[model samples]
Target: MSDVSNSSRTTRKPKGEGHSRRGEILTAAERIFVEHGYEGATIRKIADEVGLSSTALYMHFPDKGAILQEICRDAFSRLIAANAAVADEDAPPVRRLRRMIDGYVDFGFAHPNAYRLIYLTRPVEAREGAQDMARELGGGLFTTLEATVADAVTAGDLKGDPSVLAQAIWATAHGVVSLMITKPYFPWADRQTLVDTMLDAMFAGLPRP
Candidate 1:
């Protein structure tokens, strides 16, 4: 009986260890990717960072692109979850829009490396359909924004075509977050102040209720 119990414990331990090791590899890979960019971050480098032999790293992830896809997929999933919460709220369109922007900015700040990996990295072909995953996730978020903008337009709380307005708003938010992430050395105001200023500028000419 004791032998069986020990065998069971040994079997469970590797499963837990595998998950923990995978997570460590991902964390190390993210740091390396951020510092070196995708092309420059080699498998050997990531393995070194995680204290794993390259062969062992490959046991967990098939290739570098697979690692990147997993990182990007996780990042987009979090963003989608955050936006989905705002989308489901029973609130006025204008209020919902504001909340969504706030959430977007906060997410970017909280996960700067992930944000940079998704937005700042130059496009490269991804294995495991990473591009499709990103497009599907991103499209859902954009649809929510467009719908909110359309709602605001219908209620006379804002003006302009919903599709165009959504893109414009997205561009403005992207610019603000991109600058915050890529130009951290620049002398800048408080993050909240910058966000408020950018949002104010974007909404300046739109009709408000």
Candidate 2:
């Protein structure tokens, strides 16, 4: 037989290669899901995109739903971390609100796919399990925001009800980010311009001088 290289064929992957491979698969799946939506994405397509056979992919993820769950959980966990990192419990009310706003925007822009997957995708009954996980993942973040608003109310720095203020802030930031992502080409206004305008208007209307 002709001399041939066995080193290339016999080399073993690094110890963490398995986890890296799963991460790669998840990245590929997110791209496909964003481009094609839930129904259009398929395990076969994800496997092909990642240069894996379908059987190899299934070894990592039991099914497409499992992959989706993993992705959603990852995204939600990031949201919780991002919010918690900035919303200091002892900070002044206005400062906490500003930090929360900054954190929200940073997370959304940094992980556009994750933001869209969590905020924009329509819910399905079959995936209701992910909803519960989302609440669990995000409970801390919400609690942080709610507590800040409650503190502000108690200090008389803010006039509105805490829950209403919390909800309004969430809606305002989410609306701005969602519109920018989903309708970037819309002729209404520039993204930063609109976001800044909203922020300034929101602060301008806050309870005191």
Candidate 3:
């Protein structure tokens, strides 16, 4: 359900397609969620969209809520792995923080649908299981970022309250990804150049001890 209109959907895909109907369902659901909104999307509609019956869809995901939860869980798990690797590296705190920020941007472009579901969702629409990702996995991501910010502050390479700086950095990165995603039609600079310039400017302006 990640994107609504796919070639696979032209024919009703039987149960076995690459041994993982789960991916297709998720992709389809992403599109459905965007097109129909969460409440408007139902098991039957999602099933039809994915060329499966409601029963078949249930076999992959117990319900719509489960699908949303799995999307959130899978996304957070990937982000955590990427973040842990950067945070563990024996690099300058500022460098590690930059790399982590780059990785976050990379993730948003690489999996836009999952990114939207995990970050862009309105609280009420995402259901309780989905929000749990925020309380649990989402908190872990922020903690890692904040820890890195604290490290930089302690090293005198970055000047600001660690918590405040961490939030500001995350917000800026999110701004880049969200704006690019939601407004592709907008005229923008080359992505790499734009991101590099934005990062350079932000870090350069930050007061250092």
Q: Name the best candidate (by TM-score).
A: 3
Predicted candidate 1, C-alpha RMSD: 8.0
Clash pairs, model 3 backbone: 1-26, 1-27, 1-28, 1-29, 1-30, 1-31, 2-27, 2-28
Model 2 earns a TM-score of 0.83
Report how far off residue 21 is in candidate 2 (Å): 1.4
Better of 1 and 2 by TM-score: 1
Model 2: lDDT equals 0.72
Model 2 residue 81 CA deviation (Å) reads 1.5
Clashes of each: 0, 0, 8
The CA-based lDDT of model 1 is what? Answer: 0.77
RMSD of each predicted structure: 8.0, 7.7, 2.1
RMSD of 2: 7.7
Give each model's whole-structure lDDT.
0.77, 0.72, 0.84
How does candidate 3 score on lDDT? 0.84
Candidate 1 error regions (>4 Å): 1-15, 125-130, 207-209
Task: Rank the candidate models, highest TM-score first.
Answer: 3, 1, 2
lDDT of 3 by residue, 45-147 (tens): 8788767778877877788988878778888999999999999999999999999999999899888878888888878886636678877999999999999
Best by lDDT: 3
